[model samples]
Target: MWIESTLIAVFVMVLLLDWITLIVHCIVGVGLAWLAYSLTTEAPRLEHVTLIHLPIIFFAVVLGTLANYVTEVVRLEQERAMLATAGSIAHELRTPLLGIRSGAAGLRNFLPALLSAYQLARENSLPVVAIRRSHLATIEGVLERIETEANYSNAIIDILITNTRLPKLGHEDLSPCSMMRCIRIALERYPFSVDEISQIAPVTGNDFIFEGVELLMVHVIFNLLKNSLRHIAMTGKGEICIRAVSSSQCNQLVFRDTAAGIPSEVLPHIFKRFYSLPATGDNILGSGIGLAFCSEVVQAFGGTIECSSILGEFCEFSLKFPRIQS
Candidate 1:
């Protein structure tokens, strides 16, 4: 009887010990899970924990994902804010720069005549030989250079303004406007030749009244035309085609150029601000803001812009705007 009782007591002790170990393990697991959850969640409530009761590993993963998502969202918002501030400052600078360029050009154009008048007055006073015509000619030449520089400055200012302006939505007046006529008007403002523009496809639209600023639209088209001309001028033989047609859902304008197209790697970032392809040499006069402006304008008009290119074949830009209601 004594041996049997001792054996039973030993068995019970072993069972109790096993139970204690399991409880300890459970506590440790719960503590670890809570720690992980606290670290992951921004502000985890006790009620929330009870409701979900997620596994330790799963909870950690969920918290990690949420943290990453929040971080990314914050980062994106900051970047957008910075872009907007930069754009605003750029817009304000353009008008003043344009005025300065105009003023300088005017001065350059009139300075020679003013100098001539001054020389004439001096000649009438004392000695006929005191004022040299060669001196006046030299002055005129300098003025001409100044005028050239002023004109160049104006061009730069225009490009800067074109790139930075916030896309403004215009009132919709859906009507059939001649796409060809608009193209012609825009081309007349530039130095492109008739032969160059003749290559574009004829386009017409019924719900043509797009809901966007006319000036911004012009800038978009002008940039494409300018880009084409630049390529043609550089390579000596290139063609550009622009076509417009109405789709069931939108109005599409397509621009294609025969020059060496943008590389595949750089194609995605072409619309990004200040992102320019390295192949566009130093001689290229643009400020790299043209396409950025085009993107902004397109988005403002509730439209989409996309590009496709084969390295040696061609580059194409497709602009789609919402169709105006009749």
Candidate 2:
């Protein structure tokens, strides 16, 4: 009985809730189930097992029927915690990542000169750790990659945390920001593996200012970059293009990726919150919040965002903002 209940809970949690609630439930449920099992051993086994079965089935039914309510409870807890932090969690993590990034960069810069000194000392026949030819060859790449990974990690952490708090109600936070500059910052800070950035074309010319938060705008760009990359990775053969066009009437940021595009059935619902499709080898079911968050932030900032795609060809997101007079 206990085993059956546990399996049902695990299935519901993974399929519907993504395993977080499983932590609390598994620990508490296992303890309670064990107690029930012990009590069952003392009584008539069949009746006790049947009695235990009722609650578990009820819970499973609730999981199937009230999945959204369960999701709400979890999300409500996250929101409360976020309220307490004011999203400083991202800022808190940044300092340590910055320290690691700085350390890695310093090592990269000074290692070559240190290597030369080590060579001189070896020639002088001083006792030193013998650096192998192979070690020396790979060391520089390692240090550079460390710095890159640190930077990329920091960027991703910021994006993920910030995405949860979209359309931030702080109207006073908006300011005039250059669309081109924001896109550049996002591209520069985004963690792209070797040759990944090469897949992206340069941002189109024509800078325009909009009333927006720079960080929010950068995050919006990051969200787009993430989705595009995920789709391209799924197909394993595609390229990305970002363009910014400005005029008196409208300011537009266009991001296009030649990923084997969204299926017709899934196209209409891409921006729906918490609605992630299942990932099949070459398709677009990501973490589920990215594009939705982008929509929220853009619409919140007095802009509009839209997508157009063709299956097995390409996907493009066009974000339009009111052109602000400089």
Residue 46 CA displacement from its true place in model 1, Å: 22
Q: What is the lDDT for 63 in model 1?
A: 48
Predicted candidate 2 versus true structure: per-residue lDDT over 1-326, tens digit per residue:
55585656666665665345645665687679778888878662446666767686657645644665676789878756743474466667788899999998888889999889988999999999998988878985898888878877777777777776665556687888998889888878888898787888866768888888888889988888888887777779899888888877899998899988888898889887656666653222254567878888898889999999899999989999998754
Encode model 1's per-residue lDDT on 1-326: one tens digit a residue. Answer: 43345334434433443434434544575589689989999996677544453354344434444555666689768756755665566557667666766776787778878787787778688454565778778866775555455554555455555665554454453233444455566655644444665655554443345666665677688788777777766766667877777777788888888887778998899787666766667222243567877887788777899999987778899998887777
Top model number, TM-score: 2
Candidate with the greatest lDDT versus the true structure: 2
Q: How many pairs of residues collide in each model?
A: 0, 0
Off by over 4 Å in 1: 1-53, 57-62, 70-74, 81-109, 114-185, 188-207, 229-239, 246-250, 272-293, 299-302
Per-model RMSD to reference: 15.1, 14.1
